[model samples]
Target: MKLAIVVGHNARSQGAVRPDTGETEFAWNSRLAKMIEEEARLFPRIRVKTFFREYCGSYRREIAEVYDQVDAWGADASNELHFNSHSSRTATGTEVLSSGSDASLRYARALQERMGAALGLKDRGVKVRRSGRGSESLMSGRAPAVLIEPFFGSSPEGQAATDEEHEQRALARSILQATQDAFL
Candidate 1:
């Protein structure tokens, strides 16, 4: 299986920031993507590649460009990484967004289960998105794709649970397990 691991957002437009550490989603996931790629080495059958959005002039165009590249590379599946954020600072959980296709749903479910368990967060379940910020990322690719929201960075509890080297490694392992379950 060939997996495209897309780090959400860009350097110029890092998604959400963890208030306590000032870590941006782009920066965190950029590191996580590399970790996931490194973990993939254990799964000899799985080939993983990381992609970053080029902060093009427009968000829509940047997503299109990245998806185009993933398509060109002929990935078997793709996953965009992200974490949630809310003003309330209380929201917490792991959820995955899919395009509602059968294959995408499978991927979402697999990811949701693994990440929720690995992070010890509430399982928000798999959500189907036909339109919205993540819909394009999930649907534009030739292969099945899903966007992962593994915890709310704004939530102190959530951030505390995930912002650690061991937790991050667990998250990477969970992602690899999910990919194997859904595609391998």
Candidate 2:
């Protein structure tokens, strides 16, 4: 199996901001992409590809760019990495989304469960939605795809807490484990 890992946002803009740490979604996702790509090598059955390491214009454009690249790269499955944000800084957790397709949903659910458990965050569950403007064709058919928002970028304390090495490694393992289970 081949996997495409897209780091959300670009160099120009951070998807969201956490008031406390000044951390951006772009930075978080970039780090996670590196870890995930490295960890994925442990599963010999799979090959990994990365996308959107740089910014274009807006997040939607970044998503589009990732999709086109991954699609052309001929991926079996593609996952976009992101951290969530909310009006209430206290709102924090993990969320996985599918394009509402049966195959996509199955993978999304499994990934959500594994990552959520690994994260020990409030399980906000898997959500299924049709692709939209900002979504950048998550459901669009460039191999099976899902968007992973593993934590709230808006929460200062929560973001800071997971910024540790243990948490980052756990997150990468969770992603690789879920992909292994879902694909291999």
Candidate 3:
């Protein structure tokens, strides 16, 4: 399978930040995406490519460019890495957003299950969103895509759960396993 792993947000507009550590979603997920790509090397059948959204001054155009690039690369499946955030620090869980297609739904479920287990977070289940914050990334590409929110960066507990190197490695493995199960 040809997999496109996109790091959520960009350098100019990094997504939610962990207050305590000041770790931005873009930075954290960039590292995770690289780890995922490295892990994919172990699977001979899987070809993984990592992407970062360019801050082109327009969010809509940037997303379109990303989808265009992914489509051009002829990816079979795509996953965008992100972490959830809320004003209430108590909110925490692992969830995946799908494009509402059957393939996307299956992919989302696989990711949600694996990531939840890897992170040891509450399973918020798969959410089908045809429109919203992450909808474009899920629906705009030719390949089936899912947006992963593996934990809430805003919550101390959530941060603690995924703050270690081992946790990140486990999450990377889970992502590849999910891709294999859902798409291969």
Candidate 1 stretches with Cα past 4 Å from truth are none
Instruction: Tell me how candidate 3 scores on lDDT.
Output: 0.91
1 against 2, candidate with superior TM-score: 1
lDDT of each: 0.92, 0.79, 0.91
Best-to-worst ranking by TM-score? 1, 3, 2
Candidate 1, residue 76: the lDDT equals 94
Error of 1 at 152 (Å): 0.4
CA deviation > 4 Å runs, candidate 3:
none
Candidate with maximal lDDT: 1
Q: Is candidate 1 or candidate 3 better by lDDT?
A: 1
Worst 10 residues of 1 by lDDT: 132-141
Pairs that clash in candidate 2: 10-55, 11-55
Better of 1 and 2 by lDDT: 1
Per-residue CA lDDT of model 1 for 134-153, tens digit only, reads 99898788999999999999
Over the stretch 76-129, how does candidate 2's per-residue lDDT look in tens digits?
A: 988888888899988988888888777778778888998887877888888877
Local lDDT at 101 for model 1:
92
